[model samples]
Target: MIDLHTHVVPPRTPFLERLAGSDPRWARLEPAGETGDVIVAGSNFRTVRRVAWDLVERRERLAADGVTGHLLSAMPELFAPWAPAGDALDYARAFNGWLAAEVTGHDGFFTGLGVVPVQDPVAAAALLGEIAGQGLLGVEIPSAPPGAPLHDPVWADFLGEAERLGLLLFVHAVGGALAATFPHPGAANGVVFPSSIGQAVGGLIAAGTLERFPRLRLLASHGGGSLLTSLPRLDFMRATTPALQELMPQPPAVYAQRLWFDPLLFDATLLMALVDVVGADRVVLGTDYPFMGADPVTHLDDPAVPAALAAAIRVTNPQRLLTSLTAPT
Candidate 1:
């Protein structure tokens, strides 16, 4: 089955080492015994196993996991939204270049989602064209840039470019400002920055961004965080709150159905609920592979799910999304 949520990271190449050492704000890969941890702006962000860098091992592991193909993206922590715009752009290109090089050889077995310097929309849009030109599937950006929310006017240019270019945009969470809320923030406690995802997504829907940009294929990671759960509330608020009526063009659920999401939430009940909310076609299999999270292969075996819907989630849905991605001209 095609897994849309897997991640692959390039090894600590010389360029990255140089960049990191020259400026502390840049991400640096510090070698530890048997594995390594990524240090972003002096804080130990996350550890990476050998498989993170070993493509051969990754392919073999995918075979063992019964996954036929998977989409590759850089680790979200490396997005570095706080870095200087030029440095962020440089890092994005490097990550995309690494992704292109690695995935080009694998072809059918692997597709790639590049990174863009989301902090600067104008520059990000330019780089997105270059990324699309490389035949990369699309680019993954943080749920929101640091100090900037998704609804900010600054993102319009980049989002506009995405629509005009027919590029698929993955709004993955990279907890920057929001992480400060937690006293102890990091992956250890599930301090995943997905909480804002719902708000960002809801705002976009309410603001009629999807309606305005009909071709923008937006996907939310982590089962769209609280998006599905918040749908009913959004609908209620829109119906009751007069001010929201102007913002909401249609029922919130209707716009939600138009977006894509991965079944990264391991709970069968939650996964089924997500399918119910978004429809089976928009729900794709996403293992969050190698994270020791939910296994995508076992999604079909969820007790309450029907055979047809399960099959659609495992295979048909992902194929549709992947096949529909705008290829480089």
Candidate 2:
């Protein structure tokens, strides 16, 4: 099966290290033990496995997880939206180059998604050509940028360009330095991250990103966070609220069907709930890979699910989403 949501990071090369250390706002990676590195952005961020940048280990582990291929993006911690625009652009270019080079020789075994400085809309829009030229699949941007939401007028050019190029934009949810608000330990992962994705998805629909770019291959990570449960409410507000009616060309419920989501909810009932809302065609298998635990016995192995539905999530849907889903070759 093709896993759409795996993460792959590059080594903290001298260039990236210098950029982050020189600025307090940039995200920096600090070596912890021999096994991991600490990601410091707003706070002492989480440490990730050494395998994050180890392509060989990543390939072997993907094999161990029983998948034919992986769609890799840099770990969420590496997306420093708060950093200076030029610095973030530099980091993104470096990462896009490194990732494109790493995924080149594997035939179709590896696919890559690069990062961009979403905080700088004009610069970010300008880089799409360069990113597309790098042979990268698409870009992975954080759900939250600096000031305005993703669906703001400032992003129309970027979104339009992505649509024109047929790029698969994946919006990843990241809990920035504001982890203190979560209060309880691990609340950053359990609450903040996924909830952010849901908010971004709803905002985009309510704000007309999907309406403006109907065919934009926009994807939401982590089972679309809280979106499914909020669909009725979104539809309610969209139809009755005059301000929203002017902004959204289509209602949230209808626009939601046009969006794509990964079933990384880690629960069968939750997965079924997602499928029930968006239908199986919109759901794809995206194991957050290596972080949320690789699915040793994946969802496809469940006997309770019909063979047809399982096939769609595990293979057919991913293949359709990325026509170049050429893997294991």
Say which candidate scores most in lDDT: 2
List, residue by residue over 1-329, the lDDT tens digit for candidate 1: 88888776567632465566666666566766557777766787678776777788778887896778888877776777777788778878888887888888875798899888877888888887898888888888778677667667777878888877778888876666556677776452265545667777877887767667767888888788778778898899889987777777678898889899887665778888888888889988776766554444465587787888878878999988988884444
How do the residues 1-329 of candidate 2 rate in per-residue lDDT, one tens digit apiece?
88888887566642466785686655555655435655564575556676666777778876896778789998876777667788888888898888889899887788889788877988888898898888887889888877777878998898988887778889998776666677774777778877889998888887777888887888799889888888888788877888887778666777878878887776677778878778889878787876764463265556656788888888888878778422222
How high is each candidate's TM-score? Answer: 0.90, 0.89
Q: What TM-score number comes out for model 1?
A: 0.90
| Candidate 2 CA-lDDT value | 0.78
Runs in model 2 deviating more than 4 A are 14-20, 24-34, 39-44, 183-185, 293-304, 324-329
